[model samples]
Target: MTEQHDEPRSGTSSPAAASPALARLVGMPAPDFAEHVWSRAPLLTRGSDLPRDFADLFGPDAVDELVARRALRTPFARMAKDGTTLADRTFTLGGGVGAGIGDQLSEDRVLRELAGGATLVLQALHRSWAPVQDFAAALADDLGHPVQVNAYVTPPQNQGFSDHYDVHDVFVLQVAGEKRWRIRPPVLEAPLRDQPWERHRAAVEQAAQSEPFLEETLRPGDCLYLPRGWLHSATALGGTSIHLTIGVHAWTRRHLVDAVLGRIGARLSADVEARRSLPVDPGRSSGSEVAFGEDAEVVRSLVAKALHDLSVGEVVEALRPQVRAAQRAEPLGVLDQVERATHDEQGGTTWRVRRHLAAHWEDAGDSPVLVSRVGRLEVSADDRDAVAEVLDGIRDAGDLDPRLRRRLALAGLLVPADVSGE
Candidate 1:
């Protein structure tokens, strides 16, 4: 239950570190896992097996800051115990006078629930938490896919959810405490986003009873990878368990198929014959004999013809919007950015391409346009080089034409390269 209001609204100032993030994450060369383990099998890397631990990204204190200090609201924060989610009212109360809302998180109630063994879920950390946000952006770039971060805080000996499978691949980073994870292979391989584990609940329950493919206790600094559709369940051990689930929403063959078919549908919308009503059954019945044999055949033939005529360019163009929506743009700092852009003689100031801004150049006869989720900004022909250089990396603010710099800054295609968490 991700909330639209809770999505990445405020831009982050700190850009993700540009190191070989994935290589550091899995404790192996990035290519090694990409070639062998990604979407193919599970890989377990202990804390000592890696070049570093995830302390910089998130830890137990992060949870306190989010729940107690940040004034977090729901569907962003939730709790579950014994596989059942507690109601929102149990942890939320009125927003009070000037706020004029009813669903604000109640810190006291949250503490009560936590003390009673309910597992707290800090969802959408990529949007809500800074360190996780930076890390998510870095990992998304490494994986070439959309990624989301979720933190689970379970009391000792508690579990949050039942054995289930996700439609997206995930990397579980054990931040603190220990958890016993039981994993099994998919009952349905590479399940689509619409195909959840409950659809095969009977099969999943039966399979859970079988010997697990991997069963181990994950301590601090440990990590585990599971591809989409693999079944898993976890229970906290010792004192408490705090871990982050970095989920990868991978683009797959199904996306390509949808893109191709979607392009074909758009093309068919302009076809006069395709728009004509189907031949009315003489009997006006729900299912005439012709329904199965003749009428369905004609419709199928038309779609097949359109599919056969489809081009790769059409499919790619159709998929562009999805890509833009999935990939998050760099974080923006309104005050700092405006100052940099507006101030003259700001020669020493530096700024860089927005992280994951996803803006691309599009030729427009005389001028070029920067196309992205920020909407199109038609660029002046003279500033093309500066625009290109700025988007590529950190560039001197003075290097860009003042007009272009202001436009880029306002349009959210660039930001102060060194804006701190402030």
Candidate 2:
């Protein structure tokens, strides 16, 4: 059985200094929690680190700002009452005042829905909220996987959704008020993205009938980690409830197999024997010959050869490009970079690696290339050490090769370190 520890008794709230990446946010050593609880069991971390507070992401005022001022559209924001989703028209209207506006959130309609105990869901907060975007990017970088953020706001004594299981693991942060969570063991273990709770309603109901494995009221400053497929339901208690759910969509063995098979498919397409058409009619075949018999053997041999040709390294390398492509760079300050380029004499500027930009080194032909969110950039072997040094920590602009610094800065991989302080 996985060992469980109560609230961390003697740990510092320094995430970067902690062993695991997000440990500071959860109040535990990251490495220990990763090995003992991550994707293995549930954990409840209680703390009130003021600096790590999630007020910047969402709150009652933030909700009003998003719904009334952000000009959000359907799917981006949704309202649910008693577990059923309300229609878009229930809380949306044609953009009236703004030019080229599509759909705007109607505050009056949304308030009416909320008054009736409807839970407001702000989907994809990672895209809409800067704080959530940064939070997700940090966790994704640390975990080497993608992360999505969402917020749930439910009125007092009302439940948003019924007991259900998510296909992706989630880190639940109770941002405000309190929520009573009832959690039970998963009916299915580590279910795939396609495997939803609705398909096994009967089994879930049966499991919910049993004593919950965990039942607690999560107050502000509390956090919970629930692995994929863990059955759970929660209701706002006494006052309005607000929480942030960081969903981690972990990469699985199936993804690797698919990557390998995709390469195999390309190889099979080049084989003439595998491509040859089968007999049109088996009835016209000779005595012992059956329809598709000869072709089946040929296809089987081709598959065997393809499987033999597949290698772990090849599959991993093949998937790397896709991973790199998925990461997108944020809007760059082109004018600032241009101005900095002209003022090469200015040497006091300290440059740092851009935040949330996924970067890694890979072997290419005779040298290594730095693959970042922007694209794969080939650098000379002699400059690799310099690249490594810069990525390790903030560096003075004059300390770097002027050309290299300019290139990195223009590419959005490097930013002025002082920008954050500003």
Candidate 3:
């Protein structure tokens, strides 16, 4: 399964006396866990309070299968001189699998060349994987964006990657063993360069010109958050090291403008003036076709206005739920059959609801009432009576009320328990 790192420490200053160690790291203002701060700076913590028994999340057979498939790379992931590694790992049947498999690790090539059958482990964070999914959901809610997990295993002396940076911000968790990380200062601050592979190759060839701002060895339970565009490299120290990189998606004003422009383009073809033939110039002796100017300025202006409207908070808010819904929708379809079964007198009912664990929503003051078996609920003071009525049924039936239950079932909120007949 794709490994997940622990959540990074909140860099915010506590009113209470701070630890000397924490004081040193909290030099810059701690970034708010909003959409923007991800992958932008350094936030490190040692002996974190976050759950550390990462291996327990995966089954022994599954772990063995991943290893046997040669999915885990060792002794430094090999990269082409150009700093790009070709990825050939097939993704499992989930959204998380697709995101994790998209990237290449150096060891993948060596294993394939050696004719190994080990498959790369993919961890799914649906409601079924409750603990991990809970953490994921919290992070998504905190960050107001979708999050996915990807893990790489590097053996001692093996460098999983050459000196490079990611397009998105990453939270790295050291699950087991040790890894030495060297992070250079944010150079190309929030760079918009599209060709990261080429940039990585160039940076590697010119390593002598750059220096790392922070260099440290991360042991188990350590967490590091690195912002986008910061150059860094990691190598396993002396034993097998497993690390999780929680990547956050980046959105920009340019992306919003692009979307608006696309909408405008679709409407332009309907303009009769734009489609009309240019007026022919008969007076000229030359037989070349005359070109007339189409008034595209109006369309451009409209697109710019639309983009301006979208540049503020509304666009992100509008897009957030849609994005969350899409991620939440995936496991929902798969869990449908599981939610349909009725419980017999002898068997306990199992109900499963799929929730995207990423911190995708902004908590607007009031905490939304989220019940595992009932699906996501937005309760208001006015609806307290209704909510209590539903809760009454939940307490009695060990499920939601019938109408609400059917709705939740249809929404993939509650699935039938997979129970053996008594």
Q: For each candidate, what is the lDDT?
A: 0.80, 0.77, 0.49
Give Cα distance to truth, residue 291, candidate 1, Å: 4.8
Question: lDDT (0-100) at residue 371 of candidate 1?
Answer: 89
Clashes of 2: 1
Better of 2 and 3 by lDDT: 2
Lowest-scoring 10 consecutive residues by lDDT in candidate 1? 1-10
Write the residue-wise lDDT of candidate 2 on 166-205 in tens digits.
9999988888999999889999999988888999999998
Q: Count the backbone clashes (under 3 Å) in each candidate.
A: 0, 1, 28
Runs in model 1 lying further than 4 Å from the true structure: 1-19, 289-301, 363-367, 381-386, 389-398, 420-422
Give per-model TM-scores: 0.89, 0.84, 0.59
Candidate 1 lDDT over 312-387, as tens digits, reads 8878778888989996776676787777777734565665666677777888887998788778988878777778
The worst-scoring run of ten residues by lDDT in candidate 2 lies at 1-10
Q: Candidate 3: which stretches are off by over 4 Å? A: 1-39, 48-62, 69-134, 191-193, 207-209, 266-298, 301-326, 329-404, 411-422
Name the runs in model 2 displaced over 4 angstroms: 1-21, 48-53, 100-102, 279-290, 330-335, 342-348, 360-371, 376-397
